[model samples]
Target chain A: MDLFAERGYAEVTVAEIAERAGLTKRTFFNHFTDKREVLFAGAKDFEDSVAKHLAEADDDLEPIEAALLALTEAGLALAQYGDYARARQELIASSTELRERNLIKMASLAVSIAEALVRRGVPPGRASLTAQAAVAVFTDAYAAWTERGATADFWNLMQQSLADLRRAVDAAPSRPSGA
Target chain B: MDLFAERGYAEVTVAEIAERAGLTKRTFFNHFTDKREVLFAGAKDFEDSVAKHLAEADDDLEPIEAALLALTEAGLALAQYGDYARARQELIASSTELRERNLIKMASLAVSIAEALVRRGVPPGRASLTAQAAVAVFTDAYAAWTERGATADFWNLMQQSLADLRRAVDAAPSRPSGA
Candidate 1:
């Protein structure tokens, strides 16, 4: 994270990242395909954890509720990496490629959440919307937490963001034409 | 679209795309930077149209309502190209690069919507959430519309999707644990 921050992500080579970690280049290659992969290494784990939580959620929970429970769990899990996440956010903001990768990762997580909802017996359309809405709430909470720094509790942010999403949706206006 | 659908986005060349359009390679270059850019040529226009509609929405409308209006307009505009959209969707579904581009485009539109909301005097956090929720509705509606083809009215799908989102949010349960 320091290497990417001090030097631009584009300017930082794999050798340098490996050197900074006191690992041999060959060892680094064994772990990650590229320097960019290092920053995103936790993405799959995060997605899986959220999916697992959703899958294990109570049967009585609504699909969105189950997804939110997963999100809260994911937020708590990510709290330990607040500094790293914020640093990575700076790098992602600076690089279009990294931003695309991050968005794609989030999009993939939404699909996973939707699939999990389907497994929980949600109809496809409802599953999809609930998943997308859940992901949206998670993204906003994560962003707010990162922006506010480590002092903020991610779980609180996640909960509050979900509540805010509910209020926003509830307050939504009917179509202008009233059709 | 045919070239991409048949041969894959990675395999298709700009020359082939140009030839398919009955135009010279030079003419294609004059219009688009590359084959990928051709697929996303309308993205900016879509963003602008949505932002414009949102900005022009009635002052009495809620932020989410304003966003829905813009989405309604955008959906109506996109409905005219259902065949082209679905074909492009298939090509995008098959390719990581195209999918990333599509997600990035949607993400960019989200930012544009939030900015428009802010310009209309909404607070930043509210603007961001409203924008994301609106996009979630649009995405679900678009997917349903594409699947149902021309048989479904885009407006109705969008309305139904927003209603579904509201219900999903309203049904969201509180965090599972006190933590």
Candidate 2:
């Protein structure tokens, strides 16, 4: 990330990154298949942990509640990497390809969470809608948190965003008088 | 779309499309910069119509409700193109590049709706969160409608999805007894 910040993502090469990190090219390849993966190496773990946490929520917990629990768990897991995450986001925002990759990554996480919810006995449609909504809110909140230089606790931001989501829904136009 | 369905998207050329449409290549270029643009030609109109309706919705309507009205209006505007829409979706699904383009397009629409909501006096945070959640549900509902061969009215699907979104939020774990 430091190299990416100094030299720009497009200008950097894997060999240089490996050398800068004091690791051999072979060792670097052993970890990430490509240079871009270096920045996203933790994403797979993030998805898995969130799914696990969501599935462990009480059986009676609603889909959205389970999703929030999962997101809070994952946010805590990622809290220590705030600076790194912020820098990585900057690098991604610099390139269209990176942005596409990041979008796909987040989409996959939403799908995984939905599937996890389904496995916990939520109806497929409800699970999917809840998961997508939760992920959308969580992603927005995370961005807001990072934009604030990560001073706010990620869980707090997630909860606030969740409330905002509910408030928005609650504000939907009321039904007209019966037909 | 027929050409794409018959020969596959990557196998078709702009010249062939122009010729099949009884238009000169120059005329085709005047309308669309590329073959992909032909499939997405209405997207700008979609954004404009939705924004217009959203801004016109009752001032008291919440950000999400306004967005829903806009979406329903836009969906109605595009309702006549069900077969074409489904075909275009199939073509897009066949290619990673197309899928990425579609995702970016949807993201931009969400951003535009959020901006419109802000212009209508919604706070920035609420506007963006509402816009995103609305888009997520709308996209899923549209997909479901298309999957069912468009037998269900798009507006109905939107309403059902909105209700599901509300249910999901309502089910969110109640705040623990006292903070």
Candidate 3:
């Protein structure tokens, strides 16, 4: 990350990244398919954790509630990496390639959550809608948490963001024509 | 699009695209930066139209309502090109590069709508949340419309998707611990 931050993401080579960490290119390739994967190393684990959490959620929970609970639980695990998260976001914001990768990661995460919701007996359409909205809440809360550095309460931010989302949706006109 | 559909997006070159349209490579570059841009040619115009619609929306509309109204109005204009839209979506889904570009375009649209909402007196946080939710609604509605082919009513789909979003959000637990 420091190498990419200093020399720009595109300019930094896999060999250099490997060398900086006192490893060979072959060893680096063993762990990551490409340089971009370095920035998204934990994405699979994060998705898995969220899925596991959702699967274990109580059967009585609403689709949206189950999805949010899973996401919040999974997201809170990242609280220890607040500074790294902020720096990673800045790096991503600076590079189109990284930003695109980040977006794809988020989209995949939403899809996984939606599928998990479906497994919990939620209908497909409602599961998809709930998962998408829950992911939005997570994204906003994560952004706020990273912006505030390591000490911010991610749990509080997630709750506040969810409240804001509910209020915004509630404010929408019941009939489109009425707007 | 035909060339991309038949030969794959990466395999199709600017020269071939221009030749297929009976134009020279220079002419193709004059209109688009690359082959990928050919698939996204009207993105700028679509964003501009959404912004224009939002700017002209009634002041009484809530932030989410105004954003949705703008997106739906702009989206309806593409009802004429439903077949084309479906083909474009298929090509995008098949190509990682195209999917990334599509995601970036949607993200930019959300940011633009959020800025428009902020200009209309909504707080920044609320504007951001509203815009993201509105975009999610637009995305699902657009997908359903295209899935049902050219005859589907884009406006009605947008309305249905928005209602689904509202119902899903309403289903979320009011307190984090309630679940």
Candidate 4:
């Protein structure tokens, strides 16, 4: 991240990155398929952890509750890497390729969460809706967190964002009037 | 659309596409920046239309309602090209490049809608949350509409999906009980 931030993502090579970290090229390749993976490799583990958390959530919890719990926990874990997260966001914003990859990663995360909800016995349609909305909340909170330089408590931001979402939905008619 | 469906998107070239349409390569280039643009050129128009509809929506409508009204109207217009839309979706699904493009397009549409909401006196945060949720509802409805071979009324599907979103959010606790 430091190397990419300093030299720009495109200019930085995997060998330089490996040398910076005092690792062999083979060792770096062992961990990441390529330079891009250095930024996004955590996404797969995050997805797995979210699913695992949801699976272990109390049976009585609502689908959104379970999903949010998992996300909030995962988000808090990410919060520990504030500087790295900010740098990662910058790197993603700097490159179209990285931005698209980040988008796909977030989309896949939502799908994984939705499938987890389905496995928890929620209907597919409802699960998808819940998962998408939950992910939106997470995304909104994350933006706020990063924009504040990651100083805010991620959990509180998640709560506030969820409340805002509820208000946003409630403010609108369930069906358009006279429809 | 037929050309793409018969031959893969990558396999089909601009020259062939122009020839199939009885147009010169120059004329095709005049309209599209590249072959991928052929599949996505309407997105810009669609985004503009959604913003226009939101801008013109009745003042009494909530942010979500305004956004949804815009999406439903634009979606209904696309419903006329059901077969084309299905083929477009399949072509996108078949290729990573197209899928990524589609993802970026949808994300941009959401951003456009959020900007429209902001113009209508919504706070930026609330506007973003509403826009993202509304887009999610639109996506769910579009998937269902396409899955059923587009035989369903797009407007009805939009309404049903919005209602499902409401129920899914309602089913979840506003905040976790112990939090």
Among all candidates shown, the one with the greatest lDDT: 3
DockQ, candidate no. 2: 0.42
> How well is each residue in A53-160 modelled by candidate 1, as lDDT tens digits?
888988998788788888778668777777887888888999987888888888889899999999999988778778888888888877887888767776677778
For each candidate, the DockQ is 0.58, 0.42, 0.57, 0.50
Worst lDDT window (10 residues) for model 2 chain B? B170-179
Off by over 4 Å in 2: A10-38, A172-179, B7-38, B172-179
Q: What's the TM for model 3?
A: 0.91
- TM per candidate: 0.88, 0.83, 0.91, 0.87
- The CAPRI category of model 4 is medium
Question: fnat, candidate 4?
Answer: 0.60
Kindly report which residue stretches of model 4 are placed more than 4 angstroms away from their true locations once superposed.
Answer: A10-35, A172-179, B10-35, B171-179
Q: Which scores higher on lDDT, 1 or 3? A: 3
Q: lDDT of all predictions, in order shown?
A: 0.82, 0.81, 0.86, 0.85
Instruction: Tell me the deviation in Å of residue A123 in model 4.
Output: 0.2
Local accuracy of candidate 3 as per-residue lDDT tens digits, B123-157: 99998889999999999988888888657766678
Ranking by TM-score: 3, 1, 4, 2
Best by DockQ: 1
**Better model by TM-score: candidate 1 vs candidate 2:** 1
